[model samples]
Target: MSILGVDYGAKKIGIAKADPTGGPAVPLTTLIVANQKEGIERLQQLIASEGVELLVVGVPVSLSQSGAELLRDKDHLNKQMQEVLQFVERLKNTVTIPVELEDERLSTKLANGMQKELVKINGDDAVAAMVILQSYLDRKKL
Candidate 1:
């Protein structure tokens, strides 16, 4: 199905576009997901504009790491990012299309590390959307 991938965040929501053929997801513009109402309007506009049949949102899940360095998750960070998921959850009821959530632990980091022409987009909403969309694509592969 044609879909819009969203990197849900408090300040901004990253977005990506993909068709049902299972191809590379292209980065679209980012949305300023301000609050509950604003988030809904933006998402609705995006869905209509892109003719999206499905929506994929990123969920930030932090881990305790259990005495290991790898377990040290940015709890505060994810807590703040929780607003994104809240928006997505709320949208689940209002929208006609299906919504999917994927783990977005390292998408921001990946966005920050982009190089070359993408260097300008590093740490921006577009890169974040790429991470979200790519994760969705990878998951569907398995």
Candidate 2:
């Protein structure tokens, strides 16, 4: 089944796609939406057009110093994390396909590093989505 990776943000949402047979994910595009409604609507269209079967959204989670334990204190969640959770909730409520969350601790940083090496990078958001999706694909192999 084809999979779509999403690096969602308030204004810009990064997108990436993986083949049905499981392969490396590639940068797709960045959706610049004014609001969540617009973003979801565009994502629905993309999902239909791309024939995506699964949707994986990158979620930011706080980890302890040891990086073994997850920090789930709602009160301690940063604004961005809270917003992402809200976005994920709305996405889950709207989408027909199964939605899964993948840890995206340093996806953007990795993407930025990649951007410096590549001459033709498809925006930071798209690259970040690629990073998120690629990480998911790699983990599935192990």
Candidate 3:
């Protein structure tokens, strides 16, 4: 089954896709939306066209210094995390496919590092999505 990864944001969302048989995820594109509603609409179209069977969304979580546990309380999530959770909820409600959340702590920093090597790169959001998706794929192997 093909899997799609998403790096969600208020304005721009990063997209990545993995092969049906399971392999490295590749950066797809960044969707620039005016609002969450528009983003979901665009995602619906992309999901249908790509024949995505699963949706993986990256959720930013505040981590402790040791990175052993989450730092934020469940009842008091940060603003960004709250927004992402809301978006995920909306996504789950709108799509028929299963939705999964992956912790994306330093995915953006990693993507930015990758940008330094490439002369021309798409938005960092797409790269971040690739990072998130790749991390999920790697963990599944273990």
Best by lDDT: 3
lDDT of 2 by residue, 53-137 (tens): 9888887874444323433564567898778877877988999998877788799988888856441568888888888888878
Q: What tens digits encode model 1's per-residue C-alpha lDDT throughout 1-142?
A: 4788787766777778888677777778877755777877888988888789988777666322231221233244455554665576688888999887676778878877776466375346777777777777886772
1-142 per-residue lDDT for model 3 (tens digits): 5799999999999999998585789899999999999999999999999999988888887444333354335457888987887898899899999887788989999898885543146678998998989987887761
Candidate 1, poorest ten consecutive residues by summed lDDT: 63-72
lDDT scores of the candidates, listed in order: 0.71, 0.82, 0.84
Which residue ranges in model 1 land beyond 4 Å of their true spot? 62-78, 119-123
Off by over 4 Å in 2: 62-75, 115-119
| TM values, all candidates | 0.78, 0.86, 0.87
Error of 3 at 72 (Å): 12
- What's the CA error at residue 135 for candidate 2, in Å? 0.9
Q: List the residue pairs that clash in candidate 1.
A: 65-71
Ranking by TM-score: 3, 2, 1
Q: Which candidate has the top score in TM-score?
A: 3
| Residue 33 accuracy (lDDT) in model 1 | 57
Clashing pairs in 2: none
